[model samples]
Target chain A: MSQDQYFIAVDWGSTRLRAFLCKHSLNANIELVARNNGPGVTKVSDSFEKTLFDCIEPWTTEYGRLPIYLAGQIGSSIGWRETEYLPCPISPEQVASKCLIFEELGHEISILPGLSCLLPNQHYDLMRGEELQVLGWLNQRPENRKGQHLICLPGTHTKWVFVNNGQIIMFKTAMTGELYDILVNHSILIQNKTASFDQAAFDQGAKFTLQSEAGSFVHGLFSVRSKQLFSQITGQQSTSYLSGLLIGSDVRAAINANEWNVDSLDKIALIGAPHLSKSFARVLELEGYKTEICKLTQTTLAGFSSVFRATESSLITTS
Target chain B: MSQDQYFIAVDWGSTRLRAFLCKHSLNANIELVARNNGPGVTKVSDSFEKTLFDCIEPWTTEYGRLPIYLAGQIGSSIGWRETEYLPCPISPEQVASKCLIFEELGHEISILPGLSCLLPNQHYDLMRGEELQVLGWLNQRPENRKGQHLICLPGTHTKWVFVNNGQIIMFKTAMTGELYDILVNHSILIQNKTASFDQAAFDQGAKFTLQSEAGSFVHGLFSVRSKQLFSQITGQQSTSYLSGLLIGSDVRAAINANEWNVDSLDKIALIGAPHLSKSFARVLELEGYKTEICKLTQTTLAGFSSVFRATESSLITTS
Candidate 1:
C-alpha cells in the first residue's frame, strides 16, 4: 500500500502570508496537517526564504522538507522568486505545467503562475492568487469542468473569471475593495472606517446603482456623500453604502462588458474571505445573479493539492 | 456720482486663499486693483483674521478699509465664521440678501452663503465657492438671465448647475477632481504623481470611458493599472489617461444624472481655472456639447462685484 504523500502550500500576497502543511491520502483526499502565518512579501526584511522558513520550519521538523507550492503575489517580481504569468484559456493542468519549480536549501518549491488576459473590450486584465482558487473551485466537481462558468474572487483586486470546458477562458479584475479601502482610509467621503455594516444602507446603494439609467458608477459614488449630507444616510451607514455602490457598479459593468444576462447564466461562484464573498453575493443576488460563496482556504488547499499530486505522480513515473 | 466704490473679493478655500482688490466701475465694470495670496483656512494657526490681514492688510492700508466679500470654503463651518447655505432657485440678488455681513476692527466683511439644492433625484448637493462663479456666469450677459442653461464648474468638487431664467434652479456635485487627486497621490494605480500630460493617451482614455456601454467608473479605473502592466500604456501616459478617464466619466455621469441629451442642450458654460475648464471643454465638445470656457478669477470678481454692489445699494437705502 502507498503511504500518503506530504506537501506545503503558501498563499503570500502583498499584505499577509499563510502556509499550510498537507497530506495527500491514498484515496486522493487532502488532509491539513498544520498551518502557519508570516509577514507578507513586502514586509520581509531579512529575506523571503528566512520568513518562509520561520513559518514552515516547525512543519518540516515534524515531517521532512516536503515539496512546496506557493501562489499569489508571492510569484510576482517582488515575491520570493519572479514567475511568469500564464495567458488565459489555460486549464489547471496547464497552470501546473508552467509552474516555476526550483530547489532552494534542500526544499523543492513550485510557484504557480498568475493569469493574464485581453478582455473582450481590448483591455488587459490580470490576477495572481485568485487563479488557484479558481482551480480549486473547478476541481470541486467533475461537472464543473464541462460547462460555461463564471467565478468571482472578491478582495482588494476582485477577479471575475470565465471558464469553458475546464479552462479559464477570460477574466476581469475590479478594484472594488481597494477603492473602498482608499476611499474610507484616505478620501474625504467617510471619516470613520470602522463603522458597523448597515444592511439597509448597503442594499439601498446597490439597488440605486443597479437601477440607474446609464449605470454611472462615478455618479452613484457621489450619492454616498450627498445622501449623508441630506440626512438620508448616517455616518455609520456611509461606508456600507459606498461598498454596496462599488460592488453593484462592478457587477453591472461585468455583465455589460461580457453581455451576460443575469437570469440566463450558470451560478457565478464567489471565492474569497467570508465577509467579502458574502458582500459580492449580496450585490450579485440583488442584481438577480445566482451566486455560491466558497471559502478561500479550502479552495487554495484543493488547488495546491491537485497540482502537487499531479507533479508527484509524474515524478514517480519518470523515476 | 457713485465714485466707483471698491471692495476686496476673497476666495478662501481649504487649500489656498486669494484676495483681489477690485474697483466697481461707474458703468458696472469691475477692475482689479491688486491681488494677493496666502495660506488657506486650514493653515491659519493664529487666527483667520490674522491670516486675512497679513495677505490684504497692505491693500486695506492703501485702499482705505474696503468692504471684504468672502466666498468659497472660507464661509463653511471650518472657515473664519460659519455661514448657512442658501436654498436653490435663488438669484444673485437673493444670494446677496442671505449674506452674513459683520464688522470686525474697522472693516465690513460679508461671507457669501453656499448654495444647497435638492436634486431631481432627491440627492442633496452643496457648493460654496462655485456659487460666485455661477453668479458671475449668469451676470455676464442679460440673455443668461432668461431661459435654461447648464453651467459646469469643474474643480475638486465639480458642480453641474442648472439655471432657469437667471436663477440657480438646482445643481449636482461630482467628486471627480478629488478622486483623481487621491488616486494619483495615495492609491496604487499610479506611482509617479508628477507625470506630464499626454494628450493622445488622455483622449484615448476619455474616449474609452465615453463609449463604454454601462459607464462604470470603478471598472474603468482598474484599466489604468492593467493597461500599464500589459504595456498598453506607459507610466507617463498612465496619469494623463487616468485624468481623461475621470473627466470623461464625470461628463458622462453628469449628462446621465441630469437626463441630458448632449446635442439638444445649450452650450455648457465651464467655469474654473483655465486648465481644468479646458479639460472639461475638451470632453464636453467631444460629446457634441458646445462649451464656453470661463476664467475663474474673472467670474469670481464679477460675482463678488455684483453681490457687493447690490449690498452697498441696500445699505445706502437703509442708511
Candidate 2:
C-alpha cells in the first residue's frame, strides 16, 4: 500500500447526492477533488456497489481506493443499507458505532448513523446528514460549545436542533420549505412570478404569524394575492409576507414548545442558503433574538470533514 | 303545468353539486329532491350545458320549469356564463343586480353574484357560494346581527369571514384541508397505518402552535411520526398534534389579522362537519373565545333557500 493517505466523504440527501475527495496528511488541506451525480441510493437499483463505483469512476485514477465516510439519507431505510439511529444526547462514539459498513471497491466504506432524540412521553426528532454539519460546527468552534445553541438547517424538511455541551439534546423538523413549494406551485397562491424570497412579505407574514392564534396561519395566506391585487400590497411583498407567516409561525411554535430559550437568541445559527437564512434571521432579530447565518455549503463541507477526520483517526488507532 | 308553487335552489361547490326543492307556502319546507356530481365550473369543459343539465335532471321534473337560483362557483367566469361580482357591504339588490341570467331547459335560471371587497390600495377578497350561506345565517338570526361576528367555514380552503350589520366586511382563506391531505397522503409524513386524532396530542399541538414562532409549523410536522414511534407518543396523538398545530395556527392567524377581541367569544360561529367544527370551536373555547357550531349542511341549504326565495319574488313581481 502507498504511504499517501486518501479519504472520501459524501453528503447524501433526499433529492441530491454529493461526494468529496480529500487527501489527509500532516499540515494538509482537505480538497474536493471529485464530484458526480447519479441515482442516489434512494433512486437506483439494489446494486449499491455498482452505483457507487460508477459514480466515482472519474476519481479512481487518483484516489478511488480511499476509505470513504458517508452521511445523510444514504443510511436511511431506502438507502445503501439501513443503519440504526443513535438515540439523542449522544457522543461521537455512539454515532460511529451505529455506522453501517459496506465492503467493495477494495476500500473500507462506512455510513454514519443519524442522531435521534426520544423525549419522555413525547415525540422524537431524527437527523442524518446534518449530524456531520453539527459535528463540523462543533469542530470549528470548540470553545463556543459551552452554551446551548439552536441550529436551523433549512431544506425540504428543515431541522431545528438543540445542542448543549457537545451533545445533541434534542431536535425538531419543519416542513417550511415544502409548504412554500406547495403553496406557490400547487395551490392558488401562485400569482407571484419571481422565485426569489420576498423579504417585505416574509417580514409581514412572520409578524402576523407570530402574534396570530395557534391555528390561524392558513386563513391569513389568502390575503397574499388579495392584498396585492386590491390592497396594493406588492406581489413581492405579499410573497415575503407569506414567508414571514410560515417561518414566524414555525419559530413561534418552537419557542412555545420550550425547545429553546429566548435568552439564547445569540446562539441561533441558521445553516442554509444566504437569502432564506438571512430572512429567518431577520425575523428572529425583530423578535429580539440574536441570530447568525452559517454558510450552507461550508457548514455541510466542514461537517463532512469532521467525520472524515474522526474516521481516519479510528482507522489509524486500529491499524 | 299544475301550479304546485315549488322553488329550486342549487348549492354548487368545488367538489359537489346539490339541489333543494321547496314548496312555496308559508313554511316553505325544503327537501333535497335531486343531487348529482359533475365537473365544477373550474374543471368543466366548454360543454357546460351538458354538465348542468345532468345535475338538475332529477329536480327539473318535479319543479316543472320553476324559478331556479344558483350559487357558488357557478357565478365565476367559467360557470353558467360569467356573472359579475358584487362589492361587499352590499344589500340583496346588489347581489341580485350582479346575477347572470341564463335560459336552460325551459327554466329561468339566475346565478347569485359572488361578493367582493376592494380595499383602497390593496387587493380584494371575493366569495361566491358561501355568500348565500352568510345571507341565510344573517336572515335566520336577525336578533344576534348587531355586533361583529367571525364566521369560519372550514374545508379544502377554509374561509374566515367577518360580518357586521348583515354585510360581509372582509374575509380570508386558509388551505388547511389541502395541507392536511398533502401531508397525510403525499408527503414524507405518511405512515402506513392510519391514526385517529387524540385530544391530548391535539391540545398539546394547539398550545405549542399558539406559542410558536413564525414559519416553524411547517418544520415541526416531520417529528410527528418519529415522535410517536421512538418517544412513546401514540401515532394517533401525533396526528392530532399535527392537526392541532395546523388548525390552531390557522385560527391564530385569522384572529390576528382581524384583530378580533376574544372577550366576546359568543360572536364566533364555526361552520363545517360536526366533528371538525366542534374541534375548532373547542380550540377557540380554550382561548377564552365564545364559539358556536354552525351546521354546515343547514347553513348551505338555508343560503340556497334565501337566494331561491329572492329569485322567485323577483320573477313574480316582474311577470
Candidate 3:
C-alpha cells in the first residue's frame, strides 16, 4: 500500500500557484484527492521551507506520506533552489534525474527541471510548466502529436511555440496581455472604459490593419484615440479599432515573417484564458485558419500528472 | 516706420504663445520680439482679452503699435473668436481671412483661417499654422516644390501631411510623443529610475516590430519591462528599445501607407525638435527616402510669417 501511494503535482506561475494530489491507475485515470496553496516560490519572501510546508500542510494532513512533484518556477534558481535545465529532445528518464529532491517535515518533495532548447550559436530558450503541459497533451492525444504544431500559450507574455516530435523547436514571446493593460489603464485610449471585450473595436482595428498600407500603424493608433476624443469615432467602436490595429498589425507581421505557413492553418492550437483564446481563435479563423482552444487547467493538470508518472516510472525501473 | 514693417507672425500651440516681428525685406530677417504663456486658449482660464494682452504686453511695450498677424489654434472657436476653415486648392489670398477686430485693444489682429481639405462625403482634414510652413517651403523654393511631398511635423500629436501642387491634399496624425511619455512614465515600461536611450535595445525592438512575424504591438510591449525585471534585459537598454519600438513602428506604418509617393524620395521633409526630428529623418533615410530636417522653431517662424503676409495682403486688397 505504501509503495502504491500516489504523488502530488504543483503548477506555480508568476501570479498564481496551484497544487494537485493524484493517484495514477493502470488505466491512466489520475484521481485528484487533495489540493492546497503551496507557497508560490516566486511570490513569497519567507524561507522556501516555510512556503513549501504551508502549501503542503493540508495535503500532508490528508495523505500523510505522499511524494510530491513540483513544476514551474519552483525549479528556478531563485525558487526552491537551483535545479538545472534539461536539454531538449530529452526522454522521460532524463526528466526524472532533472527533478531535484528535498526532504522536509517527514515528507519528500521534488521539483522538476524545466526544458531548454539551444540553437547552434544562439542563446537557449527555456520553459517550465509549459513543457509538462505539452507532454500531457501528447500523452492524451498520441496519434495527433506527430506533425509540427504551433502552440500559442497566451497570458502576460504570450508564447508562440513551435513543437516538433514532442520537443519544443523554437518559440517567440508576445506581451499582448501586458500591452492591453497598459493601453487601457495608461494610454489616452482609455476613453473606452468598458471592461468587456469590444468586438466592434476588435473587428474594426483588425480590419484596419489588414487593409492598411505598408506602414500605417503609427498613424492608425493616433486615430484610435483622437477620433474618439473628437467624437469622429464612437467610444465603443474605438476599442474595436484599437484592437484591430494591434491584432491586425500582429497578424500582418506574423504573416510576413512566415512564422506559420499560410497553407498550414490547421496545425495551430491556442492555450489561454477562455476569452483571449477564443478571440485569437476567431481572428485566426477569419484569416482561414482552423484553430483549437486547449483547456488551460486541464492541460496544467495533465502536465503535472504526466511529470509525476514519468518520475515514478523511472524510479521503479531504476530500483 | 509703419511701411518698414514687413511681416508679423504668431505661433500659438497647446503650450506656449509667441509673436515674431519680422522685416519682410530682401533677407526676410525674422526677430522674436514678444513671448507669453498660458494663452493657448486650452490652458487659459482667464478672458481672451486678458490672454491676448498678456502676449502682446512685450510688443505693446516695445513697438507701441505694429501690423499684428496670428496663426495656429488661436483662430479656432475657443481662440481669438471663431474663424471658419478655408477650403483646399486655396492660394495665399483665398485662405487669408479678415483679421478679428478688438475695439478696446486698438490693434488689428488678423487671424488666418486654417486651410482644410474636404473629402467629398467623408470628413474634412484641417490645419492652422502648418499650412503657413508648407506655403513658406513652397514660396521659398518654388522650383523645388513641383511634385508630391510628405511633411512630418512631430510633437504632442505628430502630423504627417501630404501636399501636392502647392495645395494641401491630406494628412494623418500620430501620437508618438504622447505614447512615449505615457509608456515611460505610467505604463509597465516605467524604468522607475531614469534611464537614457539604449541604442541596442532600440535597434532590437525596432527590428522586432520590423519583422514580418511581429504580432500585435501590445504583445511585444511586455518584453520591455519583463526582460528588465527578470534580468534578461538590461534596464538602461529598455528605454531605447521602447523608443525604437514606438518610433520604428510609427516609421514602418508611415512608410507602408505610402500616402505621398511622388515616384521618388526627394520630397519628404521632417520638421520637429532637432533630436526627435533627426531620429525620424534617420529612419526615413534608411528606408531609401530623401529626408530633410526642417528646424522646428525656424519652420514655425516661417509658417507664421507666411500666414501673416498672406493675411496682410488680403487686408490691403480688401480694404
Alpha-carbon local distance difference test for all models: 0.84, 0.69, 0.66
The sequence of per-residue lDDT tens digits that candidate 3 reaches over residues A158-224 is 6667766665566555555655566777776666567456776687667756665665556666657
True contacts kept of 1: 0.64
Show where candidate 3 strays beyond 4 Å.
Answer: A1-8, A21-23, A32-56, A65-107, A110-132, A229-232, A265-267, B6-29, B34-52, B64-136, B186-193, B198-233
Error of 3 at B38 (Å): 4.6
Can you list the residue pairs that collide in candidate 1?
A: none
Regions more than 4 Å wrong, model 1 = A316-319, B316-319
Per-residue lDDT for A257 in model 3?
40
Judged by DockQ cut-offs, the docking class of candidate 3 is acceptable
In order of listing, the candidates' clash counts read 0, 66, 23
TM-score of chain B of each: 0.96, 0.86, 0.84
Most DockQ-accurate candidate: 1
| Number of the predicted model whose TM-score against the real structure is largest | 1
- All DockQ scores: 0.64, 0.45, 0.42
lDDT of 1 by residue, B179-287 (tens): 8988898788996778888988899889988887774677778889888888888998988999999999989887776544445567988888788888889998888
How accurate locally is residue B157 in candidate 3, as Cα lDDT from 0 to 100? 66
lDDT of 2 by residue, A1-319 (tens): 3444667777777667677666655543455566666666667674867777766666776654777777888888778777777888876555665667777758788988888876542556788788877777766677646668788777666788888887778888877877777666666666765746666667766776666555455655676666664554676566667777777866776666555675754657888878778877887787777777887766766676666666666877899
**Residue-by-residue lDDT tens digits, candidate 3, B183-277:** 78765466554787666677776665565333345545555754564465687777777877777777776665555553465657887778787
